[model samples]
Target: MDVVMRIEQTLDGALSEAEGAGAPPGLAAAMRHAVFPGGARIRPRLCLAVARACGAEDFSAAAATAASIELLHCASLVHDDLPCFDDAPVRRGKPSVHRAFGEPLAVLAGDALIVLAFETLARHAAACPERLATLLLCVGRSVGMPFGIVAGQAWESEPRVDLARYHRAKTGALFAAATVGGAAAAGVESAPWRCLGEKIGEAFQVADDIRDVAGDPDELGKPVGRDAALGRMSAARELGIDGALDRLDLLIGEAAESIPRCPGAAELRALIRLEAQRFLPKELVRVAA
Candidate 1:
C-alpha cells in the first residue's frame, strides 16, 4: 500500500477497535473527528520515510508506529485547542473538538487518543515485543515529561524558559520520535537518527513561527499571532523575518545532512529538500523574504 493509504487504514482500523461495542458513542465520535481528515500527516509520514530509508520492507511495524504517532499528535491538538490552552475555535477548517463535542468530551477525546496510540502500537507489536519496547520508550519520550511535547507544553507554564528547550520539547520532540521510532520499527539502532529528527522538528517549528506571523487565517486554518497573544517565545519573535527564514534554510540543510549513513541516505536527503519547499510555500517565501 502507498504511505498515505497505509497510515489512513491503520488509523481507521484503530478507531474501529476504539469504537467497538460497549464504547461510549460520544467519546468514539469525538475521537474519530479528531483523527479523520488529518492535516499533512507529516509525523506519521516521517515515521514511514525513516523506516523505508532503513530498508524496511515489512511495513507493519512502521505503519503501526506511524499511526501511533499521528494519534498522539491528534490528541495533543484536541487538548491544545481546549479553552485552557490555545482555545482555538477551529482546526483543519472545522470546529475545534471542544467546540464540536464540548470541552469535557474534548478533554476525554484527547486522553482517549493518547491511550489509543499505545494500544495501536501494542496491537501490532504482539509478535515483536522487543522492538515494541524500544518503540514504546521512544514514543513515550516524545510526548511525556521533561523533554517531551508535554514538557514542551509545560514550559509555557514556567515563569522563564529556554527557547531551544521549549522548541525541542514542544515541537521537535515528536519529530525526533518519528525518526527514532521509525528506526526502531525497522530494527535499526535508533539513537543516531535523533539529530535528523531534532533538526527537522526545529525547522518545522521555525516554519510554524513564520506562518503564525505572516500566514492568513484561512490558509493556516487556525489563529495566527498566537505566540504573541499567549506570550510564547517563537522564532519569528526572536529572529527577524529575514533571519528566521535564513534559520529555516540552515536547519533544513542540517536536517538533510544529519541522515545517519543509512542505505537510502541520498533519497532521504532529497525528501528533506522537497519537504523544505512545502514548509515555506512560494507565496510565503515571497511575503516573508
Candidate 2:
C-alpha cells in the first residue's frame, strides 16, 4: 500500500479502539473530530518515511509509531486552540474541537488522544518487541515534561521566553520524535536523524510565522495575524517577511542536508523538498513568481 493509505489505515485502526461500546459517545465523537480529515498527515508521513529509509521489516510497529506521533500532534492542536490558549475558532476549515463540542469535551478529547497515542504504541510494541522500549521512550520524550511539547507549551506561560528553546520544544520536539520513533521502530540508531527533523520543524514554524502575516486564512484553514494579536514571538513579527523567508529557506536546506546516509536518503531528501512547498504558502508563491 501507499504511505498515505498505510498511515490513514493505521490511524483508523487506532481510533476504532475508542469507538466501541462503554466509551463516552461525546468524547469519542470529539476525538474523531480532532483527528479525521487531517492536515497533510505530515508528522506520521515523516515517521513512516524514515522507517522506509531504515528498511523497516516490522510494518505494524512502524505504522503504529507513525500513527501515534500524529495522534500526539492532533492532541496538541486541540489543546492549543482552547480558549485558554489560542482561542482559535476554526481548524482545518471547520469548527475547532472546543468550538464544536464545548470546552469540557475539547479538554477531554485532547487528553483522550494523548492516552490513546501511547496505547496505540503499546499495543503494537509486541510486533517488534525488541525495539519496544526504545520506541516508547522516544515517543514519550516528545510529549511529556522537561523535554517535550508539553514543556514547549509551558514556555509560553513563563515570565521570559528564549525563542530558540521555545521553538525547539513546542515544534521541533515532536518532529524529532517522529524521526526518532521511525528509526527505532525500524531497529536503527535514531539519534543522528534528529537534526533533520529539528531543522524541518523549525522551518515549518518559520513558514507558519510568515503565513500568519502574509497568507489567506480561508486557504490556511485558520486565522492569520494571530501571532501579532497575541503578542507572541514570530519570525515575521521579529524579522520581517523577507527575513523570515530567508530564514525558512536556510532551515529547509539544512534539513535536506542533515539526512543521515541510508538507502532511502535520496528519496527522503526529495520528500523534504516536496513538503517544503507546504511551508512556502500560496501568498508567498505568488510573490516569488
Candidate 3:
C-alpha cells in the first residue's frame, strides 16, 4: 500500500477500536465523519518520514505514532470549529462536526478522539515499553496545558499574548510532537534530531499562517479570514502579507537545513521543499513568470 493508504488504514483501525462495543449510537459515525474524508495527512506523513530517516527498527510503531498525532489534530479541529471558537460552519469542505452532529455530539467526538490518540499510542508502546513511555511523555508535553494546542487555543482568550508563542503552542506543538514521537519510536534520541523537529514545527506554523491569508476557502476547506475577523494574532497580522511570506521562506530554509543532520534527511528535505512551495505567494510565482 502507498504511504497515505497505509496511514489511513492504521487510523481507521484505531478509530474503530475506539468505538468498541458500547459506543453511543451515531457517536462513532460522527467521529468518523470528522476524521476520514481525506486530508493531506501531512503531520502523520512527516512523523513517518522522520522515523524512516532515523532508521526506525519498527515501522509499525512509527506508523502508529503518526496516526495518533493525526487523531489529536482532528480532535483539535472539531473543537476549533465549534461556536465557542472559530464558529466556522464548515470544515474540510463539509458541515462542521457540530453542524452535522449537534453540538453535544461534536464535543464528545472531539473528546473521544483525544482519548483515542493516547490509546493508539499505548497500543504501540506495548511492544516497546521504554520507547512508548518516551513517546507518551513527548506527546503529552506537546498537547498538554501551558505549552500544547490547548495552550494555543487558550491564548485566544488571553487579553495579552505573544503571536509567536501562540503559533508555536497552537500549531508548532504538534509538528514538534510528530518529529519527537517519530524519533522516540525509532529509539533515536539525539539533540540535533530534536532540534530538527522543532524547526519543522515552527516552519509548519508559519506556512499555515501564510495560507490563512493567501489560500482560498475552497482549497483550504475551512474559513480563511476568521483569524483577522476574530481579532486573533496571526503572522499576517503582525508581519503583513509580504513579510509573512518572507518569514515562511526563512522558516522553510531553516527546516531544510536541519535535515542534513537527520538520518533520512534527504526525503524530509524534499517533503519540506514541496510543502514550502504550497505557501509561496502567487504574486511571486507570477513575478517569476
- On lDDT, the candidate that comes out on top is 1
- The stretch of ten residues in a row with the least summed lDDT in candidate 1 is 280-289
RMSD of each: 1.9, 1.8, 2.3
TM-score of 1: 0.96
The CA-based lDDT of model 1 is what? Answer: 0.90
Residue range with the least summed lDDT across 10 consecutive positions in model 2: 280-289
* Residue-level lDDT tens digits of model 1 in 1-289: 8899999999999999999999989999999999988898999999999999999978999999999999999999999899988889999889999999999999999999999999999999976778988899999999998799889888878888887898899889999999999999999899999999999999999999888888888877787888899877788888978899899988988888889988898998888788776776467553221
lDDT of residue 151 for candidate 3: 98
Count clashing residue pairs in model 1: 0
lDDT of 1 at 222: 82
Question: Which scores higher on lDDT, 1 or 3?
Answer: 1
Error of 2 at 12 (Å): 1.0
Instruction: List per-prediction Cα lDDT, in the order shown.
Output: 0.90, 0.89, 0.80
What's the lDDT of the predicted structure labeled candidate 3?
A: 0.80
Candidate 2 residue-wise lDDT, 64-124, digit = tens: 9899999999999999999998999999999999999999999999999999999998898
Off by over 4 Å in 2: 286-289
After the best TM-score superposition of candidate 2, give how far the Cα of residue 249 lies from its true spot, in angstroms: 1.3
Candidate 3 differs from the real structure by a C-alpha RMSD in angstroms, to one decimal, of 2.3
Query: Residue 202 CA error for candidate 3 (Å)?
Result: 2.6
